[model samples]
Target: MAHLPQVLVFGPPTIFTQFEPQYSHKYHFLNAWASSLPLDQFLHTHNYEPSSIQAILCAGGGTPVTVHVLSVLSSVKLIVTTSAGLDHIDLLECRRRGIQVAGAGSLFSEEVAEMAVGLLIDAMRKISAADRYVRQRVHSGPWDFPLGSKLGGKRVGIVGLGSIGFEVAKRLEAFGCSIFYNSRKEKPFISYPFYSSVVELAANSNALVICCALTEQTRHIINKEVLLALGKEGVMVNIGRGALVDEKELVRCLIEGEIGGAGLDVFENEPHVPEELFGLDNVVLSPHAAALLKSLPLICVTLWQGI
Candidate 1:
C-alpha cells in the first residue's frame, strides 16, 4: 500500500465521523481526540513519527491551534480550519513559522448572511415570540399579541463590510432597508453611507448587524456606549464572534431595556448563554450555528478543496 500523507486532526470526534470515510484513502488522520494523552504528548507518541505529519485539519472554532501546538508539530506545513473565523488559530505564529493557514473563505458567506437576515427578521417581527404565544398562550385567555417593528425603510448598519457583510447588505436592500456600514476603510465603489465610528453608526441605525473579523482591536467593539447609542428602538444582531459584543453588558442591556431587541447567533462563551436573555420576547438566540450547511457532502467537499 502507498504511504498516505499523515494529517493531525484537532477537534471533536464528529470531525472524524463526518469526514474520515471520504478522505481516509487519501490521508492518514492522526486523531488527537481519541488519545488519552495530552495533545503535545499525543503528538510525540503517535504510532507515526511527528515528522510524518505535514498538515493539520481543524474542524471548528472550539479547538485552538496555539503556538505551542505549532512548535510541537514542527513538520506541519499547512493548517486548514473548517470555520470561516480565524480568531481561534494563532495566525501570527503560523506566519512566523512560514506555515500556511486556510479557512472556509466565502463558502459559508451566503448562508451566514441569510441567517443574519432571518434572525433580524425574527427579532424585528417577533416571529419566534409569536410562535411561542400561539403554541402556549393562544388558547388560554386574552388575545393580546406583542407588536413588532417593520423591516422596510429601517436604517441598517453593517459592521465589517467584507464578503459576508456585503451579502447581508445586498439582501437587506431587497427589503427596502437603507444600508449604512462601518468597515476598516470605506470601499470606493460602494455608495452606502459610511461611519468610521461604530457608536455613530449605532446612533443612526434602527438595527446593527455585526459581521466583522474578531481581533484585539475589535474585541468588545459593541460596548455599552455603542449599545446605548443604539437606544430603546434599536435592534442588535450578531453573526460574528461573541467577543465582538460585551456579552455581560449585552445581557444587562436586554434586562434593563437599554436596547430594544437583540438577535444573537454567537456569544462570548460557547454552550453557555446568559440566563437573563431567555425570557425576553424581543430577543432571538441561535446556537452559533449560522454557518451550518444543509448538505453535509457539499460542506466536506468544500472543506477538502480549501485544503
Candidate 2:
C-alpha cells in the first residue's frame, strides 16, 4: 500500500471536517486545529520531514500564508484555496518561490451573482423591512409601509466585469436596467459603457453593485467621494467584499443620508457587523454566507475539483 500524499490545512474545524470525509481516501490531511501541539510546533515537526507534505488547502481567508509560513513549509509546491479571493495569501512570496496556486475559478460566480441581485431587490423593494412590519403587527394597512424604488429602468453599475460581475450584469439587464461597468481596463468585447473610475460609474448610475476583487489597488475603492457621487437616491449592493467599500465611511454615509441604501453581504471584518447599520431601514445585511447556502454540496464538489 502507498502512503497518501500529505496535505496541510489551517482553518475552521467545521469547514475541513465537512470536506475531509469526502476526500480522505485520496490524501492525508494534517489539520492544524486538530493537533495537540501549537500550529508553530506542528509546522516545525512537519518541516523535519519536508518531503512528507507538498500541498496546502485553505478554506476561506482564515489562514495567512505569510513568508514565514512558506519558509517553514519549504516543500509546499502548491497552495489551493476554496475562496475566489486571494487577498489572504502571500502572492509575492508565492511568486518568489515559484509555488503554484489554485482557486475556485468561476465556480462561485453564478451563485454570488444570484445573491447580489437578491440583496439588491431586497434593499430596493424593502422586502425584508415589510416582512418585519407584518411580523410585528405594524401592518394594519398596506399604506402603513414605506414605499420602495422600482427595479425597472434603473441604471446599474457593476464595479468589475469578471465572471461574477458579468453574471450580475446579465441578470440585471433582463430586469430592464441599463448596465455600465468599471474595471482595470475597458474590455474590448464588452459593449456597455466603461468608466475608468468608480466615482465616475457611481455618478452615472442609480445603483452600484460591487463585484470586484479586493486587491491593494481596490481597497476602499468606494470611498466618501464615491458615496457622495451615488447621492441620496442611489443604492449600493456589495456582494464581492466588504473592504472593497470603506465600511466606516459607508456607515457614516448611511447615517447622514449621504447615500440612499445598501445591501451588504460581506464586511471588512467577518462575523462582526457595525451596530449602527442595525437601525437603518434602508439597508439589508447578510452574513458572508452568500456563496455557501443550500449549495454546500456544489461548493464542496467544486472545492474537491480545485484541489
Candidate 3:
C-alpha cells in the first residue's frame, strides 16, 4: 500500500468539513481540533520525522499560522488559507522562511460583493427592523411603518477598490448610486472619483462601504474621526474584517445617532457581538457569513491546486 500524503487541517474550514468524506481516502489528515495536546506537542507526536509534514490547510476562524507555528513546522513548504484576507497568517515570516503561501484569492469576491450591497440596501431601508416589527407586533398603529433612506441617487464611498470592492461598485452603479472610493493608491484607468483620505470620503458621501483588508495600519481604520465625518444622515456598511472599524466607537456612534445606521457582518470578536447593538432598530447584524454559500467549488479548486 502506498503511503498517503499527510495534511494538517486547522479549523478544517467549512469546505473541508463538507468534502472530508470524499477526500479522506486520498490524504491522511491531521485534525488539530480532535487532539488534546498543544499544537507543537500534537505535531511532535504525530510526526516522527520533521520532513513528514509538507503542507498546512488553514482557514478563517482557525489557529493563525504564526512565527512560532512556522518555526516548529520547518519542513512545511506550503501554507494554504481558506480566506482571502491574509492578516490571520504571518506573510512576512512565511516569505522569510521561503514558504509558498496560497489564499482563496477572488473566490468569494462576487458573493461578498453581493452581500455588501445587500447589507447596504438593508441598512438604508431598515429591512431587518421592519421584519422584527412585524413579527413582534409591538407597534402602536398600522401606519407606524419603519421609514428608511433611498439608495438611488445616494453618494456611496468604497474604502477598498479591490476585487470585492470593484464588484460592489458595479452593482451599486446599476442602482444609480454615485460611487467614490479610497484605496492605498489610486487605481489607474478607473473612472470613479478617488479620495486619498477616508475621512474626506466619509464627509462627502452619503454612505461608506468598508472593503479593505485588516492589517496593522488598517486596524481600526474606520475610527471615531471617520465615523464622525460620515455625519448624522450617513449610513455605513462593512463586509471586510471586523477590526477594520473601531467596534466600541461604532456602538457609541449608533446609540447616539452620530451616524444614521450600520450593516455589520463581522465583529471585533467572533460569536461575541456587542450586547448594546441587539436592540437598535437602525442596525442590521449578521454572523460573519457574508460569503457563505451552499456550495464552494472555487475553494475546492484552490485547495486542489495549492496542495
TM per candidate: 0.90, 0.88, 0.91
Best by TM-score: 3
Which candidate number maximizes lDDT?
Answer: 1
Clashes within 3 Å, all models in order: 0, 0, 0
C-alpha lDDT (0 to 100) for residue 213 of candidate 3? 92
Q: Which ten residues in a row have the lowest lDDT in candidate 1?
A: 11-20
Q: Across residues 146-188, which tens digit of lDDT does each residue of candidate 1 receive? A: 7899999999999999999999999999999999999999899
Name model 1 segments beyond 4 Å from true. Answer: 12-16, 33-38, 41-51
What is the overall TM-score of model 3 with all chains considered together?
0.91
Error of 3 at 217 (Å): 2.2
Residue 47's lDDT in candidate 3:
59
Clashing residue pairs for model 2: none
Q: Return model 1's CA RMSD, one decimal.
A: 2.5
Ranking by lDDT: 1, 3, 2
Per-residue lDDT of candidate 2, residues 252-280 (tens digit): 99998899899998888865799999988
